[model samples]
Target: MAWSFWQIQELNKNYDLTIVGAGFTGLHTAIAFKRKYPKASVLIVDQGLGVNAASNRNAGFACFGSPTELLANYQHLGRDAALTMAQKRREGIEFLAHTYGKACDYVPVTSHELFLDAKHDFEHVVSELKLLNADLKSVGFATETFKPSLNAQLEINQIEICGEGQLNPAKLHNALLDNCRAVGIQFCNAKFIDHQLLQDDIAVELEGGMIIKTTALVLATNGFSNTTNIKPARAQVLITEPIYNLQLEGNYHFDKGYYYLRNVGDRVLFGGGRNLDFETETTTDLSLNEFIQSHLENLLRNKLLQNVPFQIAHKWAGIMGIRQDGTPKVEVLGNHIFRIEGMSGMGVALSPVLAQELVELL
Candidate 1:
């Protein structure tokens, strides 16, 4: 549906900045900019309902990476690149905590990935430790989480702890939205943004065919970002109805970060598996794919929750924008337009940090 510009009986006011998408990135960017220049007129426009992207639809893990995930990271991008990426994520999580605090259901539980294989891969374990420890030492940190004795408890394969964290994305979004309102930032419920660029000023053409002119423009709408250079990836997730005496703690990632599950009180929230059918999952639609949902349920029933009993209460999907070029963009695209995105699936932590970074640059 196209946007019908506010039928202002008709009067238009100039804005200093206009942000696209009210997701975390867009909302945070709005707050960040308003904070720096209180006198600036800031407004946000989006095509969807408020914060409906991955920002609110995520599993809420406030973490950097799982151990084996980091080892795989090292293999893919080498030690240096991997550590740099890990460090940014850690900092991003810290920034999120500082920004929202416990009122947002921000819990700091230690995340541990269990390695339970019938056969022990001690060699793979040693290689993982060497590379991971080197990466950690690069930042003057250490994790004895992989030490043999305790290692036996987690037992099975290679392990390394990235100290990743989790949080309630919706709660965080609500807080940011509240903050933006309190500070007097203007926001429209929805806008199509048919065209945008900075010739002299940022011009955002809405689906309603109304053109809003602002001094600058920021693109923060993850996944559904296809309105511009940003591309959306659909992520499907399922949650079980409340369970009794569920002992799951922190966040857990399996098969790299492709499969993840964690306890949200008595309910178990789990998602991921885009690796199963990347071709189909690469979409902006929030519709569920039966194949992914069935795969998730199968993994839960046969692998993780074999001994546990539960019933699925709800299932839904969210869109996450991929940094297709391998770079999470946060730079000037034109004279006064800034594009900030590409957090992969970890927007729970990365978005807020990118917001602050965007503000500093502004």
Candidate 2:
């Protein structure tokens, strides 16, 4: 694909900042940078037509962290680090709601973490619920954010309710794109190939020999972080046809947040099963795995929507970036290049703040 003269000139325009990957983080980072440096030329580029990652494909839970997930984070990253991460997520969700407006079909519903019999320590989570809620309160979350309860009808040992919500992912993405464009930020749908550090600028090479030079660069590819410490993990999801008089509402997590389901109107949107095949799921491929898909279907039929009649409507997969420490990696790679990745499957609730944090480093 040879570029025309005008196209080449446009591609070669010197930008003050260039960001790769026009997903949640990339777009938000561009917005943040543009707001701070209104006169600076900013550009964002991505390979996909739209956000083809978990940003647009996520289950849309406006969640900070599930009880079990927070407990695990506390165990792995300790109390202080976990609290900090939680605070970021909380602030991120609030920022998103504020920016996009509450009319983006966001529902303030209770999120639940369900534990099956003898599978997890229900009492242990119950014991720590108060402590976890306190930790959240310390970070500005509402007190008693997590509480223990039981729903025998759901066949669970225990359930914890918390302040979480759901939103329209597509709406949020489009809103950000509109906001970015309205603010005079340029976006190009080109795949980033490589980047090199020049004396005073970073030369970013896109596919087909197109190069974009910028004084500063940001890599917000998240799970698509090809060369960084971020590991790509694919999550498969399916939605069911509308069921008659469906009573389920709110978001749900089971098996330590490995599986999740939420009511999309009268239909149920279910996803997650990476734990069943971590090796295979740890890839950037946006393809479904029958082994995992079948398990999800079985779980949906036997556990989630048992005795309820419904048909499968759609199935898809999205990739997420995971880090060993379960924290997003946002750091300055050089004076001119910055890298942000490892959302650890919490990009929806973390990217907004992470983007602002990345801009602060500029």
Candidate 3:
């Protein structure tokens, strides 16, 4: 496609920095970098083609580390790395609380982890909780971050944990967008195709033959990133129509955090099950998976809300970036180009901190 002078003049604008992706990491990175350099001209461009960004579609659990998840991390990444992960999560949550405050609809409700009798006996779960709590205490968290609890309504063994909460992800995204605009940041809606490093600037190629030039470029596409080390994991989620006299509250986790449920007003929001068909779920596609979605509905009907007559109000999926080895990627790809991704489904409580780290590289 040949670019006309009028079209080129209208579409091409040079910026001090350009960020791709409009999700948490990209938005936060833009805000942090603009704040550090108040006069810098920043533009954020995203494909905005579908409901693919996990930032706005996640279950909104302001979670750091669930017990079983932390235990697995400890086994896989060593005690020090696990502790570091926990600490970073805590810090990220704190940053949200301090920075966005009530704008995100944050509710510091008690978080619960349910152990279905079919999967775990009470005695065994208690032992695991003890070990998890002890490890948490070593890093300034209360020795009893998790305490034994029961949900008599569901007849399941559970544990209550502190220092975790829930929020409306959409609200958080809006708040970030508002802040970015308030700081004079610009936004463009376009499909990114490729980029080239020039002598003095990077030329970003968009669909329809549009090009944007910037001194620095940042990729925050996460799961959609075309990197070998990172893979996209699609999380399937559903919500029940508001049930009368619903008693569920706060964040809930089960099956080693592969499945989760929480109450949003009288509606129950639940998600996960990528573990059921890892191969199929490991794609950037946002369509629903019948097998995983069926399993979730079964759990909702027979396990989570048994005998409680309700109807599914909605169903959707979000793509999250993950690494095979369970490590985050925040590094420079080349001169003046950076990659900040691979949250592995923990982007909610990790993006803020990771965004700051990415800004430091600038």
- The best candidate by TM-score is 2
* Model 3 per-residue lDDT tens digits across residues 1-362: 11111121233379999999989999999999998999999988888732368887889988877777777788899988888888888888888988885999887888888888665555766788777788788777776898988889887778888988788898898888888878978777788899999999999998899888999999999899888988999999999999999978788997778988999999999899999899999998889999999899998899888889999999999899987678775879899999888887788889999899888889
lDDT score, residue 264, model 1?
A: 87
- Each prediction's RMSD to truth: 3.7, 3.1, 4.0
Error of 2 at 20 (Å): 0.2
TM-score list, all predictions: 0.88, 0.94, 0.92
lDDT of 1 by residue, 290-323 (tens): 9999999988877677678999999999888877
Candidate 1 differs from the real structure by a C-alpha RMSD in angstroms, to one decimal, of 3.7
What pairs collide in candidate 3?
none
Point out the higher-scoring one by lDDT: 1 or 2. 2
Error of 2 at 36 (Å): 1.2
Ten residues in sequence with the least summed lDDT for candidate 2: 1-10
lDDT of each: 0.72, 0.82, 0.85
lDDT of 2 by residue, 1-362 (tens): 11221132245468999998777888889898889999888888878755476788888888887888888888889999989998998888788777775646777788888786676888888888888888899989898888778766786765656667788888888778777778878777788999888888888999989877899999888888876477899999999999999988888887767888899999999999899899999899898999989898998899778899889999999998887667885878888789888887688789989889888989
Query: Residue 217 of candidate 3: its Cα lDDT?
Result: 94
Clashes of each: 9, 0, 0
**Which is the better candidate, 1 or 3, if ranked by lDDT?**
3
Which regions of candidate 3 fall more than 4 Å away from where they truly are? 1-12, 121-125, 128-131
TM-score of model 1 relative to the true fold? 0.88
